[model samples]
Target: MIIAVVDGMGGGIGAQIVSSLRDELPTYIDIYALGTNSIATSAMMKSHANKGATGENAIVTSSRKANIIVAPISAVMPNSMMGEVTCKISEAISDSEALKILLPIMPENISLVGLENKPLSLLIKDTIKVIKKEFNIK
Candidate 1:
C-alpha cells in the first residue's frame, strides 16, 4: 500500500513517523514522503521513506495516488505550519479518498478538544498502532 507521510517546517514529525513505520511495517509497503519544502523532504528522506517529493504540486499530485495519508493535524489546515501548508495542499489532502491518519498535534491557533496533548514520541507510537490496526498487521 502507498502511505504518504506529509509534513512541513523542519519535517521532524514526519521523519519520526516514517522511522517508526519503517521499523514496524513490512518493507514492501511504499512510504511517500511529501514535504512542503526541500528541507522538509530531505529530513524525511533521511528517515528512509521509499520516495520523497517537495512543494505544493508534489503533495497535490501524490495525494490522489496515496492509499493512506499520515500527518499532523495541521497538515489539513490551511496556513498551518507557520504558513508552510497552503490552501491547495490542505484541500488536496482533505479531499483525497485515502484514509487519513492524522496525529492530533498542531500549532497554538488550532486545538482539538478532548484529546490529550501527548508527547511527540508517544504520538508517533500511537500512529503506528493505528496504521497496523487498519492494515491488520501484527
Candidate 2:
C-alpha cells in the first residue's frame, strides 16, 4: 500500500512520524514523504521513506495517489506557518479518497512538541492500529 505522510518543517512531529513508520511498519508498504519544504522531505528520507517530494505540487500529487494519508489534526487549519503548511495542502488531502489518520492535539501558535495534552507516540500507535485494521495488515 502507498502511504503518504505530510509535514511542514523538517523537525519535531513530522520527523518522528517518519521514523516511527520506518521502524514499525513492514518494508513492503510504500512510504511517501510529502513535505512543504525540502528540509521536511530530507528528514523523512533519513527515516527511510521509499520516496520524497516537496512543495505544493508534491503535496497534491502524492495525496491523490496514496492509500492512506497521515498528518496532525492541526493540518486542517489554513493559517499554519510553523512549517509552512497551508490550507490548500490540507484541503487537497482531505478531499482525496485516501484514509486519513489524524492526531488529536493541535496547538494554536506553537511548535508541535509544545502542544500539550497528547503524547505523540501513543497517537502514532493508535494510528498504526487503525491502519492495520483498515488495510488488514498482519
Candidate 3:
C-alpha cells in the first residue's frame, strides 16, 4: 500500500509520522513523503520514506497514487500552514480518494467541538492502529 505523508514549513509533523509508520509497518508498504518545500521533503525523507516529491504540482499529482494520506488538518485548508498550503494542494488533498488521517492540530482561530486534545505521539498511535486494522496486521 502507498501511504503519503504530507507536510509544509519545517516538516516536523511529516517527519514524525513517517518515522512512526516506518517503525510500525512492514517494509512492503511504501511511504511517500509529499512536502510543500524541499526542506520539508528532505526532513521526511530522512525518516525513510520510500520516495518523496515536493512543490505544488508534485503534491497534486502524487496525491492521486496514495491509498492513504496522513497530514495535519491544515493541509485541507487553503491559505493555511502560514500560507504554504496553496489552493491546488488543498484541492488535491481534499479531492483525493485516499483515507485521510489528519492530526487534530487546532489552527490559530479555529477549534474542534468534541475532540479532546492529545499529544502528537498518541494521535500517531491512533493512526497506526487504523493502518493495522485496515490490513489486519496483528
Best lDDT goes to which candidate? 3
In the range 18-112, model 3's lDDT, one tens digit per residue, is 99999999999999999999999999999999999999999999889999999999999998988899999999999999999989996798888
Residue 50 of candidate 1: its Cα lDDT?
Answer: 98
Displacement of the residue 17 alpha carbon in candidate 1, Å? 0.7
Higher-TM-score candidate of 1 and 2: 1
Model 1, range 1-138, lDDT digits (tens) per residue? 999999999999899999999998999999999999998899999999999999999999999999999999899999999999999999999999999999988689776789997898998888888888988988
What's model 3's lDDT at 51?
98
Cα lDDT of model 2 overall? 0.81
For model 3 the local lDDT of residue 71 reads 96
Of 2 and 3, the candidate ahead on TM-score is 3
lDDT of 2 by residue, 1-138 (tens): 899888875546777887888777889999998888888788888888899999888898888899999887766667564747677787888898999987765666555665456588988887788988888887
User: Model-by-model lDDT, in order?
Assistant: 0.93, 0.81, 0.94
Residue pairs with backbone overlap in model 3: none
Cα TM-score of candidate 3: 0.97
Cα error, residue 92 of model 2, in Å, equals 0.4
